[model samples]
Target: MLIIPAEKSLDWKNPPWMTLALMLACLVIFVFYQGKDPRLLHTAVQHYLDQGLDRLEAPIYETYLEREIRLEGEADRRTDLEAFRETVAAGERASLAVTMLMDRPFFDYLLANRDLLMNGRQRQYWTEARVPIQQNLINEISAYEAGLVPAEPSLYTLVSYQFLHGGWGHLIGNLVFLFLLGFTVEKALGPGRYLLAYLMCGVFSALIYTGFSWGSKIPLVGASGSISGLMGMYVAFFGMRRIRFFYFLGVYFNYFRAPALAILPVWIGKELYDYWAAGSTGIAYMAHAGGLVAGAGLILLLGKGWFQAREAFHEPEQEEQDRQFTHDYADAMEALARMDFTLARKRFEALWRDYPDRPVVLEHLYQLAKLRPDLAEYRQRTRELLNQYLKLQQPDNLLRTWQEYLELGEAIHPLEAEEHNRVLFAALRQDDLKVAEKAFARVRDTGHRELVREAGRLLADEFGKRRMEPKANEYRLLLKTL
Candidate 1:
């Protein structure tokens, strides 16, 4: 699930300078600096294998994993350890070497057992190979100085870590949240204050993460913490004021108006739940939570009035009208789901009468009208929806509507060949032979002889592929007659 402020659109006249700079910086670094990560990682891992580092470290790492599995006895980590072992046994030399090569904790483990793992020649050779990879490769982009290492936090790392990202997906995800929240936050706080607040939030986010995972060697790198800060500020600056938010529930999506503060608890609660439930998932949930709290706190301390609304934002011209319609549409759908046909019909017809542009409203009204087929509304609605189905470009919805219309025994009064041919073409475009056959059969006796023949030809080929040769020949005979 994802939720974001949808109250404002970008305005070219008044731009968010600090926000754009931050986005550009992240993009530039990813394209230029972190762009080298893939090559550097490949070269380092290849060298590790070329120097036979795997043979020495593989056994030691296996021993280390076994000890951890036995000592910790956690179900999840045990699964991970077993999976890691499978990679080792599969002779995935590059992948196998990379675990120890990039992982600081494994490096420390190897250091602690240097004499136990390697003889003099092996030890000297491994050391000679390791130094360059650590200094020139890892230290360049993923340098311990740039990534936030909880075991060894510094003022420098706390601020700098927000600029590094683990992968393209990671950078892109942060970039989206950065833009969504950053533009408004920067506008509210001004460029200087926004930059300062962003770094400060990052600092606090790291501190909280360190407090939870102290002495852990994993280096956390990403702008999630700072983006989370902007989220907090977005809520605080708006406070009890209502704003539009776009939300997704896996499959369907919609926008809702709610007090900005109403979403903060949900955001923080999700992070808190993830912090405890997904402690080993490598995502710093605590840091995200910390950033949220810090951003809100800073905004509150400065006073809400100090931050202003985005005057340059492009609010939708139809927003006020759409809000009421959005609610009514949801209510009408709910009535339909509840099988309250009377209520559903009334509400949808009202919407159709008022908003003739809403094609979906016609679809629902047609569904209701079919039940009362003895009435004039049934034919009126059938003709209305058939026109809409032909004009609309959504093939999936069109096919479904036609299927439902046929199953419901719907027919247009004085059926027109042009409409039938259009529906047949639409169905054929989707390769929906079922609807195409039904629609073509309606227009086959009419003057649309060429269309019938072409459609029959396509149908014959489709049936041939399905190995229904008799059905294929039936259409072939029809094409010959046409």
Candidate 2:
């Protein structure tokens, strides 16, 4: 089953650069520093192959083989050991040697016996060879330092760990969640506080992970902890609002809207179930649960007006106004449907007066004007609606208004020069020379010197293409004067 949140209740005016930077930082670290380096593992494999098993110290070899038996089990260990012996007997080609060592079972065999391969009689020959392989196995020296190891907790790892990820899939999954929930949280908390809260949530998550996995050496990494916190905050802030979600269950697919907070318990409950049912599968479900608890608590405190002077609350005035507009707009549309022109006009006018900035209200007004063009008030309303469309800079509305103007035989005097140019260009593209000519003339009359010059040049080009030298020359003269 696949379930994902669709959209949030809030809108952001600007792009979230801080969140973007964090993602970029993770990518840079993974690609440039960790993934690109190939020295250690490759070198160690090459060295072991060149020296051969006869050079190996006996005591170290026996101890190493025992460790391999314990780790990989006897049957798998025997299989890999035989493969290594066969590769050695077959003239030990460098390519075949590297391949054998790279295989997981064979790699573990070589790692366990690294000390035997590097020391005593072969010390000079294998010193550099053994160093890289042993270090790579024991330390995960290049990459794992950035992750938070609960067994050996560090203050630095608590925050830096969130920026590190296990693999491309891990990074991508975390980034997707972060973008969905982070932007909304940033918008709600504001940027500075949002960054602080994100880091704090990561720290809290790590603490929870440490408590749960105190004896485990595996390092916890990724941004899921901080992102979980954002989800928790989302529930606290917009719990009552119905939010749409897209869900897929095998072949079945559908969308449903539910109260925002309703998903929180489901998420936490799933994590709890997974934690117990799956045993330790490497995922830090405890950290996710901890982040959720921390975020909900923090947001609740902020709601009580503790963190900042301003309390986080919904705008009742705006909500009420929206509700009223929806009610009135529907009534106006219903009146128009019944062909009660007088009643529709009055209702639309009331809507226009109350919601001057609403594009839908102006649209309905324009529709009403088309129905009763004989009325002076209706004609005037058409002009007002056209002007409003221009102000809004909506291309569809501008084109519709232009069509309505032509149909009504109204002079396009009030249309802005930019919109007039757009109409001219659109007409030219359609090869509607008559409409283009009319639009160009209207734009020329506006006395926008630059637009008039541009129109003259375009007309000149069109005429020249048609082999009308005289008309083209006339426009060229007009352009030169401009």
Candidate 3:
């Protein structure tokens, strides 16, 4: 009869790894866009080469980089690199054209370079490009503010900010965390809501960061803002549940389960510590704080009692266990009435331990339990019964017997089987088969012999659809036994 609170009932079975994967993907793109420096470009080409992208698109990306270097400034020059850059950038649609041209001969290269271009080099590129990036974000926001699009914060920076990062360590750390947390949260919330939440959190965090650190000229990057949002919601919804983490150091590994709620205090403390230690050491702590709050609030709103009430109320499994006990008791009586000793013995044996105080019923049930074919402990039940009956004495035992019989027959008091069966028989005579079947089954299930026979006959005749041989034989057999 215990009821669990609706807010506490969240499906926290799986970790939010999907959200993390999404964050990684976003990280790669962010790195590429933000980390476009000569060293980064060289590293990207090397990575593409390592990944077997050289044959597909490495040459093309190299060519494009060379052209940019030539137009901007050249740090390194080697062999066919210059021609390759010119050829690729000369196309009508440089980006798509470069992609198409490279795909045929250097597909792997494109993928390899994709991580480099998207994630950025320590995001070493240039903060100047971020102006356009932020400007584009502001433009998108303006559209919404001007009523051209929905008032969605996600559109402002969620997509773009995922690619931004503080430095190599900052980028890698944020991305790794994002990949781990994003996937799971996304799956739990579902794609659309997860995507919306992620982007909104990112946008909100970015705005907060910009407001406090205005014109500081730091190329604010990293998925921490969005990923922090996921962590916040996770802790809010799953609270005290243990979350497993695998800590890694060079060639060593260890695991531990920490309460989900602990993440918030630790995270907040770290941000505060960092903000004080180095006032904005390539991390947007304000953004992370804002994102965490937003995520927790959103999940709470969604998990509210009213929202839960809109869905069907699902009681905890204990209710099912109770119903199972009741059902087994009912089934035991039905089996005993049909002389299905095998099933009855099993059910009564089960009930003996579960409801031992009902000794009047247990006397018969104890006898039935003793008849269990595979019972190795029947002797113990018999001794218990003898001891119980000894306590009842003559007068009390006789009174208990009459009380049990009255309960079994319903001839008096709680209106037993006598009148109920008559009513059932009358209904059967009038061909009100449904009523007859219900009443007869109800009485027969309690070892009411006459009622069982009547119900079986009516069921065979009226409901069995002209009685197939198997059914007729079964009914006849049951009737004969009764």
Candidate 4:
């Protein structure tokens, strides 16, 4: 299941540079910097093997495991220790070297006994290989050095960890939320304030995680906590205003309108529930919950006094354009109903100027023109009405309009050749023989040469389809000369 606010009408006129910069920073770090992790890890492991540090450490680890097993008093842990001894005996020391090196407790044990375990030359190899690998490639690599470690939390890592990711999946998942949720919050708070809010949320999330996981070496990474904070800010920024939300429940999905602040509890509850219920999922749900609350708290502290209302979540209660058109159209019709021809024409002409394609405007204006042909607008109005009618895609309807225009006035001119081409093709498609034959003649005389030939071929096929063999033969024979 997933849910999010379906807001953010992008205005390219004002680009969200902060949001874009944050995204670009994460992408560059992941692609060019963190992308080198696999190779670096391989080098570290290779260094451990080349130094033959495993041979020296393996028995020490074995003895440590043996002693630990008796004190550990857990069957599963004892089995694991016995399995470690079997792996060492099987001579898979290269892989085992990494485990032993990363094992901080065992490394401390090995350090305590290093003098007894190795000669001076062996200690030289250990120092040469292990130090560089452990510092740069193992624990001090990109995720660790910069990422938030609850055991050793600092201001630098609290902020820096938001940029590091464990893998591509982790980076992409967090970024999608950032883009979907960030732009609106940035727009709402404006960039300067939004950046401050975002970092503050991240810092607060790290602080919360530190409280939960105190004195642990594992480094927490990813932008999820910051993204979660944006989620919180989204709710608190908008307050009680109704906003559209999109939700997906596996096979089904839809959009609905609800108060913006209503979803905050659901978000916080889900995060806390997942943290307590799902056991250890490698996800920092507590950080997410903390970020959510912190984000809202920041808004509560500084939002109302700081900024105007939220533009991001606001939806139009009524369409201004459609409402205005209806009101203006009704006013015009009311003037016409009172038989105020002068006022009616004025209203209609204005409507026509704005809404040129309104059929009722054409019908009434044409009638008014007939009553006052002395205005000398009848010819132009007739031509305009006929042109608009021709735009109707239905050929039958166009033919009916053509018939009405002809019946409209004997003095009215037929449409120009380019315009007549539309009628000619419409007549052909609909098999209106009387109109098609006359149109065929007009186009043959004044229409485009290529268009005339193309229409001639179609006219011939249309004739054959009608079983008018003699007429089909006549046009088909004429095409040979053309």
Best by lDDT: 1
Q: lDDT tens string, model 4, 151-189?
A: 789889999999999998898888888988988888888
lDDT tens digits by residue: candidate 2, 140-242: 5333466787777889989888887777898898888788777667766767777887888889988998998785556788888888887777676765677
TM-score rank, highest first? 1, 4, 2, 3
Between prediction 3 and prediction 4, which has the larger TM-score? 4
Q: Report residue 241 deviation for candidate 2 (angstroms).
A: 3.6
Task: Tell me the spans in candidate 3 whose CA falls farther than 4 Å from its real position.
Answer: 1-24, 27-35, 39-159, 166-169, 240-259, 305-482
**What is the lDDT of every predicted structure here?**
0.80, 0.70, 0.54, 0.78
lDDT of 1 by residue, 1-482 (tens): 88888776665577988899999998897788777778888887887778787787777777777787778654555766777788977877777777778777778876677777789988787678876777777666564647888899888899888999888898898998899888878767778878988988989988998998898878888889888888888888778989989999989999999999889989999999987787578788999999999888888887445444445332343565599789999999999999999999999989988788889899888878878776678767776787776676776766666566555554544346666677788887887788888888877766778777776887898889989999999998877775
TM-score winner: 1
What TM value does model 3 have?
0.37
Q: Clash pairs of candidate 1?
A: none
TM-score of 4: 0.59
RMSD (Å) of each candidate, 1 decimal? 17.4, 10.2, 16.6, 11.2
- Once fitted onto the true fold, the runs of candidate 1 whose alpha carbons sit more than 4 angstroms away are 72-76, 143-145, 304-482
lDDT of 1 at 354: 71
Q: Name the regions of candidate 4 deviating beyond 4 angstroms.
A: 54-129, 307-482
TM-scores of all candidate predictions against the true structure: 0.62, 0.55, 0.37, 0.59
Please say which candidate is ahead in TM-score: 2 or 4.
4
